[model samples]
Target: MSGNQGSFSLFQEILADQTQEINDLRQYITNQEQQLNTMKERLMRIRIAVLMNESVLRPFFRVPPRQRDPSYYPVIDMDLEAIEWMQANNIGGQQNAIRRFEAIYGMNLRKCKILVRTAPEEIVEAMNQRAELHYSPCYRRSLRDNSKIKRMKLICSEIIKLWEDCQSAAYPSDQIMVKRSNLERLLNEFWDGQGKKTEWFGKRKVNLSGNKVV
Candidate 1:
């Protein structure tokens, strides 16, 4: 129809899709883990029996036993310290997944790092091991593909809740941790690129009324 109508329709579709996706991810984050673990346990029991029979059970009656693989989702029993730390850093229990992945593979998941999954500091001296074999890194581009700018705001708000929940959480502590300038930079990063460039916006300001020049 009209240009404004088309824009509205596109916005509506995006909102609907995002809401559904968030709900699905929240459920998957909460559930499906148990299903994967159960499947893996059952598979292990069947695997032993299949190996003993040596397979070749003469085609007709012998069908390959169904085997389920464990989902790559991080299965972890986080330490109390890690739980505290994760809750300290990330709210809604999402950081646990990140910490578990870090514990196993030694990855750095800070925002600036762009979410690289690397191994922990357990360097072994093995001559036979290939240099690359001992160390592997994977990058998930999901960091830059954040669902929306609002999510970042929500994360900061939730983190503030956690700090408030803590015994020693206070303004001075965070003052040392994050500078005011840094938060200003964070705002700039999110608000930027959407509006016109501010680099040379007021470069040519004219002094019409006063004798002001810079």
Candidate 2:
């Protein structure tokens, strides 16, 4: 009887030790996961900062005329130039113009289509005038810079708000993740809409003509 009791006591000690070790391992894994998430958040912030800086600085770094390559033409807010090119070449109809713009600029077909469809009539008229007067590349560069800076600032502010909301919400991890995914999708849609609006105003010759869109 005495030997049996001793054996049972020894087994309980072993089981207790195993349970504590398992808990310790779980704690270690949780700590590692938290650290990994922190690192990822930091990396995302850094990437956004780099992109914003690039957008701001890009207009200043004009390629020398001799070194300029057709493939390196700036991609953002070139709708006015594209339309002028289309008109000059006798490209008829908005759809045809959009397709030609996509092919010439190597831009996404959907984005090209959106910009063409959404451009205000006033802006198109201004582009026509600019084309007639032979606007300088400097004018185009200024337009692109302003559009890019405005979009970047808007996106950055929205993303900051999203982060703040996520951090302040008292939600479980899974719920927070779902919210983040949804926010990202909404952000992309907002970006697309903003691009179209920016193209509308950015391509407008109003700054030079001193006219405002009604």
The numbered model that scores best in TM-score is 2
- Model 2 misplaced stretches (Cα beyond 4 Å): 55-214
TM per candidate: 0.19, 0.28
- lDDT for each residue of candidate 1 in 77-121, tens digit (9 for 90 to 100): 222223334456453444544453344333333521321122111
**Cα RMSD (Å) between model 1 and the true structure?**
24.2
Locate the minimum summed-lDDT window of 10 residues in model 1.
120-129
lDDT agreement with native, every candidate: 0.34, 0.43
What residue runs in model 1 are displaced by over 4 Å at the alpha carbon?
1-151, 167-172, 175-182, 197-214
List per-candidate RMSD values in Å: 24.2, 22.5
